[model samples]
Target: MTQTLEQIASCISGYDPNALPVAQAQEFIARLVPKVQAVERVAIRSALGRVLARDLISGIDVPSHDNSAMDGFALRGMDLADDGPTLLAVAGTGLAGQQFTGPVPPGHCVRIMTGAVMPDGLDTVIPQEFTTLNAEGLVSVPAGIVRTGDNRRLRGEDLARGDAALHAGRLLRPADLGLLASLGQAEVAVFRRLRVAFFSTGDELRSIGEPLGEGEVYDSNRYTIWAMLTRLGVDVLDLGVVRDDPQALREAFTRAAACADAVITSGGVSVGEADHTKRIMAELGEVLFWKIAMRPGRPMAIGKICEPGNAGREAILFGLPGNPVAVMVTFYAFVRDALLAMSGATAEALPPLQAVCTTGLRKKAGRTEYQRGIVSRGPDGRWQVEITGSQGSGILRSMSQANGLVVLHHGQGHVAAGDLVEVLPFDGLT
Candidate 1:
């Protein structure tokens, strides 16, 4: 028997994002979730933005040998005495990519450049400006300075052999590529990008570049969601726009389940005459929950799709609200964490900061609110957030001008101008 939305939510101890709290939502997803298993090996140069499948251990020392950290002269530390002028003959010059052969004799120094290997028997380096070159090819070092191992970079100072350079589940970045290259790692093993299917459903929504018919608007949610997914490093399978018909919704759901690891759609989940997504999802997969007690995104559906003739894999299904702002907020609030879990990322929540409210805000109790606000550093060097002009979910311009989401907890009524609030920065998707 298929479980209803509420029943399914109850079966999972912490499935309700609102009532169960944000921390619990994170814990439940982390505990009950398993990341995708497909892995791929690619060159380190091409592995940027890919999730690591295994730990990367260093095969050799980072510098490979002891090298000079400055352009100076290399000599024995005890050769110079305090307040005494010590003279030494210049033996050879060492530049990058070249090493000085043989050891430096007792009254001799080597002219070494930065990144050049320290010559044998040389224990210290003095800057070229500190030494005087005589016409007889002799170097003079001032006395009273007894420094050992100065301006020398030891072998493996950055990374040593057998040390783990990167751990599993880490997302590769540009700096990571340079680090891997320094360790001579030509290839890296990483998890393949998760394939996600997205679509927008509504009789009143039309794609861009199409003439608007009577009572129809452009399908802005699809493109918005696609951009967010692209920032998340997901391979998007765009299914185009689907009408609010049960048969069409069912067909799209089936195809999505067969091909995508997850499916996301905006609109057609609420209780209305043309909302057939809920009913069609019931026929295809079990609907987990709907109607969270949150502003702008109250009507949401979460489920797992079960398809015929395919090995059963839990395919996440999210039915976001129809409003443009609601769709954007809900995607960050709920879907982003789930997708990160699917990608094997442990930290799910967005980076948050504390900011002071610059204006009084009014709100009703018993429902959580995500108000768009502009955050900027005040003259006092403190962060101050102010709500935008409008708070309507249909106002897309408000989101455009906002820098972060000011969160109002449930049961909190109104906030004063100086009250502190938690702010989630809007630096784009993840």
Candidate 2:
């Protein structure tokens, strides 16, 4: 017999986000599961959002050699006197990407532009604005006493040779690409996107573009889940809407297990006349656990499914609730962390934020609650959150208007208007 929602949640409460203790899950998965096997060497132009497969070390010093950091005159520091104006001849001019080959003679200076390599035997640079240039190629510096290394970029100032620029298992951002380009790296090894297969199951569900039949509604959970998966950069294989047939659900689960790293389905996991996802999951693979003491998403299920040919490999399986909001919340709370772990990301459990409640809220004490609330800046410049009109699982409009979730713990009851509560910001997720 299936356990009650409260019983099931109690059994898993002590477990970490990976559904196991932190150290245990880390050790177990590290030994059993392989690192993302597929790696692609793509050009830096196309490496965004891809995980780095190896540490990037600088092959040579950045800026390679000493150069000028500003448009100025390059001369020996001793050439500038403390009180009197020192008049020197301008031997040559150096611009960006061009160098003055000749050495600096005594009482002589070279007009150097920004990013130009400093000429040999010259260490100090005075801005052209601070000096006067005569038509006869003579330069006069007034009260110019400069340091030896002033306005000069030393070799390897930005990055030294053999220094680790970026570590492995890091997701590449736009700025990361630019850093790679600065190091003259045209190609990088990155892990391939994880392929995820997902769907929704219910006899009352109907696909879009079809006529509305009696007692049928369009499947919105499938589209919403797909959008969320896309936002995470997962390669999604949408298995479409599956009816409440045991054989059909079984076949779809088998197909998904064969092709995807993880499979997600909404509905058909709760106790009902048409619920068959839990049964099929039991027959195909081990159902680790099901249900949780949480409103809206009590019938959540987590397990693994064995593929057809690959008997050893198992794909993760998650069964969410039928309510649209329940499905969305459960995906972010449970499945997102698991997927991030599989992608070699350093997964951290999100901590709830404290916010003052602007309105009184009512709830029972035995189950945890994720009430959608609107967060606004209080007159005191602190965040104040208030629950929306309704807390029903089917209220999708409330989710849109809500900016965060006011979390009520399992043992807590009603909260007074001015009491403090932990709120998870919705902007961080969707």
Q: For candidate 1, what is the TM-score?
A: 0.89
Q: Among these predicted structures, which one has the highest lDDT? A: 1
lDDT at 284, model 2:
82
Worst 10 residues of 1 by lDDT: 22-31
lDDT of each: 0.81, 0.79
**Per-residue lDDT for 229 in model 1?**
93
Candidate 2 steric clashes:
0
Against the hidden reference, what TM-scores do the models get?
0.89, 0.79
* Stretches of model 1 off by over 4 angstroms after superposition: 1-20, 83-87, 134-146, 271-275, 311-313, 363-367, 409-414, 418-420
lDDT, residue 92, model 1:
93
Show pairs that collide, candidate 2.
Answer: none
